[model samples]
Target: MADAAFTQGAETADRGRLWVVLYLATTGLVLLLMMLAGLWMRLAQSGWLDTDPALFYQLMTVHGTGMVGIAALGGAAVLWHFLSAHIRLHAWVMGANFWLFLIGVVAILAADFPGRFGGAWTFLYPLPASSQGVWPVWAAALHLGGLLVIGVGFLIWCLELARGIIATYGGLGRGLGWHVLFGGSTKDVPPPTVVAATMVAIVTILALIAGATVLVMSLINLAFPSVELNPLLAKNLIYFFGHTFINATIYMGVIAVYELLPRITGRPWKTTKVFLAGWTLSTTMVLIIFPHHLLMDFAMPVWAMAIGQVFSYVNSFPVLVVTGLGALAILHRSGIRWDLVSTLLLISVFGWMAGVIPAVVDATVAVNSVMHNTLWVPGHFHFYLLLGLLPMIFAFMIHLVRVEDVTPRGGDLAAILYLLFGLTFVTMFLVGGWASVPRRWAEHLPEWQIWDQIAVITAAGVITLTTVFVAMFLARTPAMLAKG
Candidate 1:
């Protein structure tokens, strides 16, 4: 433990540690808040009770912005410590980065409800471009400024990664840096986590900042509709950011799982190299392949769209197959008894694996055009975001608690029940998405009503699960709460 401590001072390093804690708490709060609100809105749509449609839009906007922010900043924070291991006073830099990230979160959350009441979290330029009537100019400015702040924080951290890799391995070249930093493996090859994290950061940040630039240009285009803000390019920007965010979730979650699963089961995951290479290839390809989502939008070139479809299919499915199955192969040979955390982790993987079929199929050129904006998008993503990413966060939290020997006071059974209800019902939405039922619509024609019904039911179940999980956390407060 002493050697594990770096040259950084106790106070500064502790601040960095606190930042990570705050980030997770903030992330969980935002996630639960968004899901719970969504569930409520769905319940109202189902005729149980009605909530304000205006407020519902706010919830949607907050959800998107919050989730993206969490994945980018919070996810990076998780990897930062590993990368910062050798940096002297990395704690101070980490602490500052964390605060800046939190500042961004607060700004976004604050801007969401009050700003024009636009429900779209991605902001989809030209809509939020104007601030005269619906929302004041100040609000839009605040949101953009907040995003810029967050982006800068991450940019600084990436520089840290680059510097740290050089210090450790004597030089930072291409391919991979994270695996090398995490473990002292020297090689011409880099590890999957390093490649994924750094690439996700690079791709998403550049795309988002470009989207921001387009946003500014879009303000001019608002007056000149013919001036085209590159809706196609804008859509690509979103895909670049959105896809990487989801992938980063999987990448970071895998890193934590790889580290902890070994300690828990007394068996390290096998074929680490295969899993690493698989992720490296997949992340690189996925970065360029997001144009696949635009196949249905006829404005784009047919050939480009075709390339997207091919790459998207290849990137989405195969990586998970090799890596996920490889993980199972490693786990299968392990003889140790499973615990609550291990169960949840494996279950999370199951949800991700199951979710991929619909996502992969939906990305097909034929299917995407039909199901592009439907409940299917939500259905497919809930698997990756909710079941895949959320469970990892839960499992990681539990790992922290258990390692510290914190008492299992609050959430023993409640967490399990929540997982059951949450996942079992979320699948219904995936089915609806598969059938081409549109999402975010309050009412649709008879053909779409069936899918809407399923979504509503699933959303309500999520609410109930959220309530249970919250209760469990509160219950365990006395036992788990402690100081570093």
Candidate 2:
């Protein structure tokens, strides 16, 4: 019986590793491909290529949807692998999640490329139905249907995680370490577990909202063309889902930091009441924070917009104050040797913090009134997702492989080039937005073309260096694992 149990454990370990590789590889390839699409659009806007406007919008739709999906998948992989060490996450569930994501991605790609669906990633109501012959009604339906499938998959994954936590840690409140926050003992709960608890709780509610608002509505519209869903309600639902989904990506991606930083820093990241309190605050705030995305909707309630700005301010405080300060204090004068993984992890926190400034500014109704339609929207997200979450994902990928003392040659050069060029690329977007340049345009005025040109050049360098780094990392994985 003991031997059988040991064999079962070994099989689970092997399957977990395989799932990690599958998720990582799929996400990395998709990200690079979408980055290429983004580059093409930017170059076309710079007047270097006379691409058709319809084609540009189609690419935009794919790139936008693909990037968000990939980010969530990559972050889920990181969180799942690490969380498994502390809890009982079934390998088959994760495998199913990956397959579901892949199916949804393929469906979306078909709709965008072959079916020629181009209502932008948001797929706002009326627009999907009113594509003006650019795509068939069925194509738009397929696109939203694909997203619904993915949403169902995500709901399943989150439910499993929640179940695992509940079974292992007694209940949701205990898993979240809320007992300690409410004046109980904090001795047993793990910090990473608290983060996982926070994520699952928040995402579960938001996912339901997404299904009801965006995916279900879209499906209903397709089946009953005269269903007459409220446009304002649909818009609210779309942004709510879109905003929560991407924000969840960053939160999920940052789990790597909470789990791995202690290993690298030779410190214990305790699940103190304060820590739990911060995440608890985040848990409450993230749900209501979608209002910030709707600040520009005049039809939206003033109370909702006010709530958006207030939550935006309060939301930044908990995450930044708790995690940010804790991370810095852990790293400060620790005499720790900084390697690629450690450096990337550290930089990710700073990138996220820096990115929030722009985001908070944009969340304000006054500033959003002026900048919401500009490139600033993309600039803020690109900063956090690109420099912040993506680096954390890369770091976690590196963590998976048990490398020896020897570092790969050119690792530093690759990291430097990727970081430097990537920053310049996102910065140019912010600069252009400051200059009042609009987003999602295939053709830029001569004045705005310069920003597009510079962004393209920097993006090319970033992508090139990233490709080389990924190749090197993959090549070394087998040897590194063999050493174990």
Candidate 3:
């Protein structure tokens, strides 16, 4: 009987590991493809490639949508893998989400390539309908419909996670340690992973709902030309959804740090009042801070703009400080060994913290007036996503395949190269913004091409190193899965 039970447990573990492996593998492949597309765009802008302007916009649409979508999927895998240890999760829900995501990707690609839907991923209202005859109405509808499908899949994923957390912890509030924070209960305070997952589930659910509303509304207007939407309201909803959804990816990816860092340092990451407060504060602030994206809209109300600027300053600090300080406290004098995974995890914290500096600067209304439409916007996001969030995801992938914690030959070299080139790439964007270079233009002036040319070189380096990392993971995955 005992042997049978042991076998059953091992099988369950293998199944869970298999799902995670699938998720990471898909993420790595899609990420590489997206990076290549980005490289192509930079090359075109640099006059190194002679791509058509229409094709440039199409690739841009795919690059943006693919990167954001895959980030969320990868983050969900990390969260699910760790969070399952503490709660009961239905693995079928995860599998379903993956299939739905693939279907959505197919629809998006078809709409963009064959159908020529060049509207950006934001699908900002009326833009899809007013493609100036460049794209058909059906193409716009299909793209919007594809986004809705993706949002629905993510919504289901978050709901399942919420269900598991609630069942185990008694409620989302308890999962976030609201009871411990307010009721002063010393027993049963959830760990850092649970706290983070709870926050993600809450925010992602809300963000997806907002995204679905906007997508559906846009689809309706696409089919029926007479149905008009208030552009201001559409922008608000879209930014609220887009900003929150992307931000949640970082929050989800950070779970890898919370779960892995303690193991590396031989310490436990406990949930404290400070940690709970930080997450709770962030939950509120993240929802309201989306308005900062609309500060340039003169039609927007004064009160909303005030909320955007004021809360932008406040929101950047809480969870970051708690997580950053917590990691430091754990690593201090703990004699943690360094490896590719551990090194990347540490860099991720720094990247996230540093990324906030530029984001906060842009969030300020006065500074935003001049810099809102420049490469500075991309600079800020790429800093956090490339250096911060992607590192967390990559570290987790490397962690899964490692039989031991020792760094492989040249692992350190690869990591250092990634950081060096990533920093240079984003810095060029910041510099371009400083020089008032506009973003999202397929063609560049001769003077601006210098920056684009430099970025092309740095971006290639980053992509080559990332390819190495992903290749390593793919090669070792079979052995790791078999061991499970």
Best by TM-score: 3
Per-residue lDDT of 1-484 in model 3, one digit per residue for the tens? Answer: 9999777766665676678889999999999999999999999999999999999999999999999999998898899899878876777778888888999999999999999998888888888999898999888888888899889999999999899898889999998899999999998899999999999999999999989999988888887889999999999999999999999999999999999999888899888899999999998899999999998999999999999999999996999999999999999999987778888998899899999899999999999999998999999999999999999999999998988754587676788789999999999889888888888889988898898999999999999989988998999998887876
The digit string of per-residue lDDT tens for model 1 on 119-138 reads 37666655666544666656
> What is the per-residue lDDT of model 2 for residues 102-138, given as tens digits with 9 covering 90 to 100?
7888899898889999888888888988888989988
Please give the lDDT score for candidate 3: 0.91
How far off is residue 276 in model 1, in Å? 3.6
User: Residue 9 error for model 3, in Å?
Assistant: 6.9
Task: Give the lDDT of residue 280 in candidate 3.
Answer: 91
Clashes of each: 4, 0, 0
Clash pairs detected, candidate 3: none
**What's the lDDT for residue 92 in model 1?**
55
Q: What are the RMSD figures for all models against the true structure?
A: 4.4, 1.7, 1.6
lDDT of each: 0.61, 0.81, 0.91
Candidate 2 — which pairs collide? Answer: none
